[model samples]
Target: MLMDKLREGAQGRGAKIVFWLIILSFSLAGVGSYLNRPADTSPAKVNDQPITAQEFDQAYQSERGRMQQQFGESFAELADNPEYVRQMRQAVLDRLINQLAVDQQAREAKIRIGDQQIKDTIRAMPEFQKDGQFNNELYLNLLSQARLDPNSFSESIRNQLLQQTWASSLTGTDFVLPSEVTLIDKLLQQTRDAQLYTVPVAHFQKTVSVTDAELETYYKANSNQFRSQEQVNVNFVELDAAALAANIKVEDRELRDYYEQHIDQYRTAERRQVAHILISDKDAAVAEKQAETVLTQLKGGADFAALAKEFSSDKLSARNGGELDWFERGVMDPEFEKAAFALSKPGELSAVVKSQFGLHIIKLVGVQPEHERPFDEVKADVLAKLKADKARDLFIDQQQKLSELAFENPDSLDVVSESMGLKLQQSGLMTTSTAKAPFDDAKLKQQAFAENLRDTNANSEVITVGEGKAYVLHILEHKPAMVRPLADVKADVEAAVKLQKAQVEAEKQAATLLSKLNNGEDVSALVKELDVKVESKTGISRTGATLVGTLLNELFRMPHPAADKPVRKLVAMPEGDQVILVLNKVTDTDQPSAAKSMLQTQLAQGRMIASQAALLQQARDAATIEYNPLFNSQPVSE
Candidate 1:
């Protein structure tokens, strides 16, 4: 019931924001909890906790960092859209506010997060530790540098623990009944019998024609789509991990020692290919007796494959003579696994064994014993990993120096380049379209185009692209963003206009066909009259491989058919293809096997997640949340 509400509410933007807010609370686990300093403006406040603007900016930057990686070149395009920025910032703020709510709820419930918990968490953090042990002086020094006192920092750690505990209490407490599991399983695995009437976008595209004026009008109206990409050229210095790895030299003695120490890592586990004839029945006694009878037949020199194919209840493996391909331990039921592994030789059979699935007569078919590859064969991999490890250690030391040098001498990358022996390099004028690595990296690009770097003409702080790789750059040249002239994109504009018209015509034809089909028109007659092609099928699963993605979704979304009438839906695919669906019947699973167990687990988890999300919403409602003038709750028009 809770899951149904969540799925239904998921269509709303508010519910999605709330769902993601729950996720973000856990993701930003150790962020600064609360700041008490009096400020001109507060971004938001949850109950008694005042959220500082700096915290909001930090969260926003983290969000941007994630988006920068995922969207790549397109992320920069998002900046031009003000609404995206507003929503992103609001989301971050909401997450922070939700976190405070979680903390409050945990305290109200008498959850005690002691100082020892905070101390343990802080000690475990790599930033505050050296050589895997907590260094009090280092921790204090780093906190002092950040201008965060030890006391306040420890408080933040306490909050993180409370939030963690609170999140833990929310899950692992919900469950599903057997009936609920069966119903959900049936719904999920249900198949449909349907017929498809497709009107190809290509057919309409060939029939449609657009005027030059229409093309020009579209180009002018959607100028943003044809805007020139923003870009920057920079003079930079980089400490690359691959370069460092190449320069390092290792002794043969060290290589031999390392190989010997970690030799077990290269060893492969033993695997067995076995066949079993399963005797699955609700009555355990019946199943065990049947399995014993099969075992007796095998002992009497009956062919194993023939008996398995005839008697095995597991239909999937039975067809292949009950052959289950090579498997290692930990994948099968404990009793079944132990029984299967106990067979010492090929063609050896196990006595009837009881498992979760019922009773099984097991046979050992083939074996591949555990073995390690020769050192010569694995030398290349060993060397690569060793190089990576050495480079990572070197990078940590060098990265700190790089950041210090760039900041202390901000005028140019020359200082860091000369000090670290890295060559000072210059990038060609690269637009968002033409940007290539290492400059093409999100952090590097963001730094290259940052207002402060451009305004000050100073070297950027060390920007890390990946593990053991960092760069410091200063912008040398900039290109202001502009839309391309209509003449330059004339061909693209013409294609767009034609496709738009063609899509409209295709949708019209598809909708008309759908109306006719639902109103009792025969599909065979409409195929000739509407110039569309029809394909029919039965028992199409949700994961139907032959069905187009959009049409498949629409097929299941439609209500079940009544009597002779079928459920009808028209789908307009993004790429201009149109499909009219006629869903004739819904066939649900009659007797579920392991699927019921799987759904029970999944439904239990879903119920917990839904409960957690609902609680977060309730917390937000109960708390006093105030946003400054910078934030507006009203929707932003695109």
Candidate 2:
């Protein structure tokens, strides 16, 4: 319900507000409106705080950027939808509301998260820490790169922790009830031990007699379903890459002049194949200088591989004696690539180059000289470009005729198909779950199987299915709903019945095993009698997709593993059958360092989602939201 509201809000009046506000802000700045205007006029108010037009527009822009990253092409379509913008604004408002609430609560509850605590938390973050250890420089550099000041970032973290403390209090109140556990056990405890029985549907055949009068009656009653929709006949221009290439004409003189002017583009840059070593920044500048001294010795007749094997700090590369694969210009860092490419001959040693990776001494083992192309040699390339240009023009010509003919003449796809030389294909009675045809483009398949298309009746509609090609679809026929004859699906139904029986048998056996265990009978002996293997699991962690196996998602939600609860976890494997785990114990791990490090990522994502929800609720409660009367009056962008 909330998601639906958010979706509606995103597409309604909210989009108009965002668009107009942005335009006005830009226009105001251009004309110096702010200089002559009073500062007190705000767009709206939230919790007694003025929501300035400037602030609202800034928030809208931020939301747009996030939407672009998340939805890409979808965001472009959504941008024109006011309800979508409304929802986005609500999300921003939700965040602000949550932050304010958390700040107030933190103050009231005397929750003081100190700088040292923030430092400890930051150090514990795996992203900032290097090699499983805290490095202050790594922390500073990474935060700065993310455009985040460390103090502000830490303060944000503090606010999150305070909010999480509140959220945990609200949503995570734990309780145990035997009745509830029993019902859960019954629902979840599934097992299979029964033999399957098959009933072949193919063995049964039914003969049906339809009178001519009955056939006529049926056809007349459901004539709309049988009748094909009016198809399209169109002739249009089409533009494509091949047509563009065909139309491009390049003269001999023009090619020669263009080649001369852009000679540098044709000439390949000189390249060097080099191998080098890197040393750790243990003593920062001193270690780098010392490593350079060692590098010089190797360049002056020392074995390059041996020196690398001894001095390189990069373990993976060091094992191969710093033998980095050959790199070209732009592949390596600018300073390193420049130094390497500047070498005139092989086996030449270059001066030390400093990079963020560290200082590197280079040695050239191979050289490739730069070469330029003559204009005459590339004439064929020019001619091919000309043909492609022509093809594009022809395509565009065809497309325009196609759209016009299709739009003008309905119920005549054959005319357009014949003229365009495209074969008409028929689709089977397709549902939304139909598999993509072999010849169908991925985009076409996506459109054909969209939920909207599935519900739509017979109508000739144009859908852009290809990257540049459009399809004028004609829904030809539809099948009416009827209960399938039992003989047709008897085998499938029988197989379903057998699987259900097997599950019943397995559950029955599990109930007996539980009773035996409660009576203090040997659990292992009982399992042996039942001829089932006893599966064991170990070292399950609270964090990560590791150790818990594929069925871990099911287990994590289980209140407790044992306590006679039914936990169906994947049988300790990447891919395996489900094991009905009688949770033996729920153990908490003592990886405080790991937990503290991972806390930021998990808490931040979860809090952001909750904060957005809260913000939307606050905005919805305050505003008299309405859609434009003209909206939904016409078909919108498909």
Candidate 3:
């Protein structure tokens, strides 16, 4: 009834957002729970605070992951290149230094973030939300998976906020001029007319040729490209509770016994539908006297609902005839709940009662009595509980045994395999690329091929593949990294050589056409000779999709045509396609209101970024910094 009354008055966004607010309140209730490490060496330091090696590694890994997500396959192609990886590491270190610098300065300024502010920020993150509500469990699980605790996560967030707040505070002088906005809007709305001809790399493949000598030369020069990933065959014993549960058998007697033992689990609690008229005053005696008067009036058959609306102090529920909705035990004040449940029939009125909030005359609206479900009704649940209980106990015992045995007898899993009655599963030789389930994780794959284990035939420590599943494995055989022989990869080699030659030829021909056009000569003859037709496009924006990004950007970068003259250039694309572009005209039109708003937003963002960067650089300029040697320059963490 309380819900019904609230709904009647609830309007628009206010009604919709109430649930979100409730969820927001409890979003971080468990973040501090389940919330450790070696003394790590420093890779760098700022203001005498060590930037530990582990911290650097984690930072680099997080940056690499962001790039991978944003750039996808393009990032992957250069992910293993030494120069690219070094630049990535340097960038990550620079970011860390900047963040640390800001953090130090913020503390000096006495800038602070409240715990509630941090929690509220975390609660509002879309990534932590599911179906429009913050999922506390999901948030905790992500932190766990990221190897972060609440303290570390909160500190990280605090630093970010400090940087943003500090930057915004300093950017008060970073206003953009209307002239600049108009200029930017015009540039953004600029359109180009151009003639385009695509030189497909595949078109020249037939004209290119390669021989065995060339293939051999290329193979030797780039052997690393052809080398096989180091691989291993493993034998493992795994424990999976779900898998184990499938084989567990529970008798009818056991199911019945479990049901009886935990019968409360199947019983629903008694609930009361209650309504009350509260009479509150500064004086307790006066409040009681007023409540007794209301009770007397109710006894005289005055309409309870009408009296409630006129007299109750709980205005929210009073508007609904003092309805408190249906609530189970433990949900209300102990004394109030006791008095409310004592009444046997609907419309039964209780004597004036005094409680924590005020004095009240209560009415028993209805009741939902506590009841246990019949055995047949909950039979499936009882069986499942019994099976799960058995499986869990069995899993815990066997997991302990597996860990102990795997450690004690590191040479083999056969001991644990037999001891735990788990079958030893074997797999075919597999590289990280071809790893099977349970070994697909790069860390697990690394352990499978660890030199210590490979040399001594030792079982790995118990590793969890996921919930309810874990395994200990030992390498049975290993194949060290080796280059593929030319004979074995002849087809791939030929294809690569042909593609390389074709791309070179395509660009060369496109360059010739570009040269002719630049000299103000007709390229129609060359285009005809190449059996290609030029396409004329009008009003192409910066984001034109007909041409590759490289070419389109190049076309827009060309100067505006003067006295009917055209701008010509040759652009090469990453995918090996070449574009011969002739820019005929450049025009700027009045931007729509939406375009103006977008340009304003973009200009503001750019200004903010510039300010933040300048501020950070100033910080870095004044900060004391140091870098230490790294014994090994590791690849960018995937």
Best by TM-score: 3
Local accuracy of candidate 3 as per-residue lDDT tens digits, 179-284: 8888777787788889888777777887799988989888888788888888789998879999889999999999999999999888877778999998889998
Global lDDT scores for all candidate models? 0.80, 0.54, 0.81
Residue pairs in clash, model 3: none
Candidate 1 structure quality by residue, lDDT tens digits, 1-638: 99988788897999889889998986666353434333345677788688876666555665676786688655865765778887787788888899888888889988887654565577679998777766566787877645567776778778878867786787656778888888777777889999888887777777788888898889889999998888788898878888888988988777777788898877877888899998988887787788888899999999989988898987778889899857677546679889888999999999988876678899999999998988888888888888888988988888998999999998887778888899988888887557787766656776777888889988877777756678888888888889999889888888888889988988887887778777776657656755688889998888668686777777889998898878777777788888878889998867785667877878888888888888788888999987776555432322
| Per-residue accuracy of model 2 over 138-194 as CA lDDT, tens digit each | 677766644456656677788777666654554454343444444334333322111
Better of 2 and 3 by lDDT: 3
> What is the TM-score (0 to 1) of candidate 3?
0.59
Q: Hey, what RMSD does candidate 3 come out at? A: 20.3
Error of 2 at 196 (Å): 26
* TM-score (C-alpha) between model 1 and the true structure: 0.51
RMSD per candidate (Å) reads 21.0, 18.0, 20.3
Higher-scoring candidate on TM-score, 1 or 3: 3
Q: For model 3, where is the 10-residue window of minimal lDDT?
A: 31-40
Off by over 4 Å in 3: 1-166, 245-393, 403-421, 452-454, 457-461, 474-477, 519-525, 591-593, 623-638
